[model samples]
Target: MNQRLNRTAVVKRAAELADEIGFEQLTFTRLGRALGIAPPGVYRHVSDLDDLRRAISHNSARNVAVVLSSACAGLSGHQALSALAQALRDWAAMHPAQYAALQIAPDPNDTEGQEAAHELISVFASTLRSYQLEGNDLIDAIRLIRSTLHGFITLELSEGFKLERPIDLTFERIIIALDAMLRGWAV
Candidate 1:
């Protein structure tokens, strides 16, 4: 706790606070309290609440891209897709608030944010290359995968799945379906 607090450290702590207290509840005041400093002290690391949120968003995107890239490493086709899907779901389940942060569109003018976002898409595109997807096809496939994962995770996080069957089974089935669709994709 005696370590010097910098922007990276502050943002890392803020991400933890978000996971613990929910992203919507994450504020400079709360982060400052958690850091054992006055609320105004947070301004040294982040300009304001929006700045803090943007930092958290960028960090969240990086975290997710790393996870997905690691999962898909040395894998291809259905194996790669399955690993990526599982990684995405596991990351979201483990860090709901940080995962929620990824839902926010990054500032178009922010280079770091743009790079982090592109990193994620690059992972997906690399994995889907086995399907011979390129150009608009690759873009569409990325959107499909992202939308499907986001929709399912959002619902799961909100406890919207009211079913007698196990949720894990459903998630696995969805991945299987996605893999099949991608294999036969034409457009």
Candidate 2:
């Protein structure tokens, strides 16, 4: 007998699988087996591995945006930046696998995927205005901060730190570096 499946439930399950097993290893076969369905059965929800990846990335990005938006609320300038940076770092630390999946760039043609990706960056860009940023400088600053936080978290999660210094200290140092950069931001 064939089992019935809910589309929403399947996508949620597939998303969980993506985080647990990593995006690259997520296949319809694996998801179907886990869900007690045939491999082809999953085709009703996900067309292929790429579609599955897009779904996973979209979910992860949306979750990150929720966290970031909450953190930056009612704050401005350095305070906003600090709140956002810490929030992003904390989210990434807690959900390393999900965070990694969220880093995948979405295809511009994929409307859903693009909107998800936009939410993530838009939150940062909006918080950036609290710094009195504008034009190319604003764009550049946002890129710098995002890259810094993302790179640090990615490296830390991968055990890339080689020094005897505490990881906490390294993160603090990063915040300080960003603060200094922002202080001279308009120059």
Candidate 3:
């Protein structure tokens, strides 16, 4: 039993530690020490750092999907999109490390990885469906929304938005523009 350790426990602790420090700064040695185990002992729970990252990303995506879906509950169209966007932004602000971990692209061959990706996509699809977007239009809508929001988030987190404009206002304006695009995107 490794004295009370399990894959879930290891991953949970590792993710918390990653948030405490930074994602890239996380290491098996540090995770093991945090979990009160030896470096090699971590191998029992995770294959390697990438494996651990993939696990974290999977869990993070699932968590965000739940959050976004809950935010959109009983809402539709722009209301749902706004809630989803704000929830994502707030979640990222709170869990910067886990949010960053969620950015790791899933390996196509990995079922677990792909499932996690689908978990997030399904949330987007549900919201987009309210707009009656189908086929490539729906896919492209999701992509445009993701690309714009992800870009803004990545820049904000990295302090790349050094400017005179307030980010909060900027994000609000971005959402308005995005919603406008979504409303007219089908045409």
Strongest candidate by TM-score: 1
Q: Please report the TM-score between candidate 3 and the true structure.
A: 0.94
Model 3 ranges off by over 4 Å:
none
- Tens digits of per-residue lDDT for model 2, 14-66: 87776677757778889988888889988887777777767778888898899
Number of backbone-clashing residue pairs for each candidate, in the order shown: 0, 0, 0
lDDT pick, better of 2 and 3 = 3
Task: Single out the weakest 10-residue window by summed lDDT for candidate 2.
Answer: 1-10
lDDT (Cα, tens digit) per residue for candidate 3, span 1-187: 4699999999989889998899999999899899888889999989999999999999999989999999999898888888888899889878889999988999899899899999999999998777889989999999998988889888887889988989999998998898888888856
User: Model-by-model lDDT, in order?
Assistant: 0.91, 0.81, 0.90
Runs with alpha carbons beyond 4 Å of true place in candidate 1: none
When sorted by lDDT, best at the front, the candidate numbers are 1, 3, 2
Residue pairs with backbone atoms closer than 3 Å in model 3 (clashes): none
Pairwise TM-score winner, candidates 1 and 2: 1
- Quality of model 1 by C-alpha lDDT: 0.91
Q: For model 2, what is the C-alpha lDDT against the true structure?
A: 0.81
Best by lDDT: 1
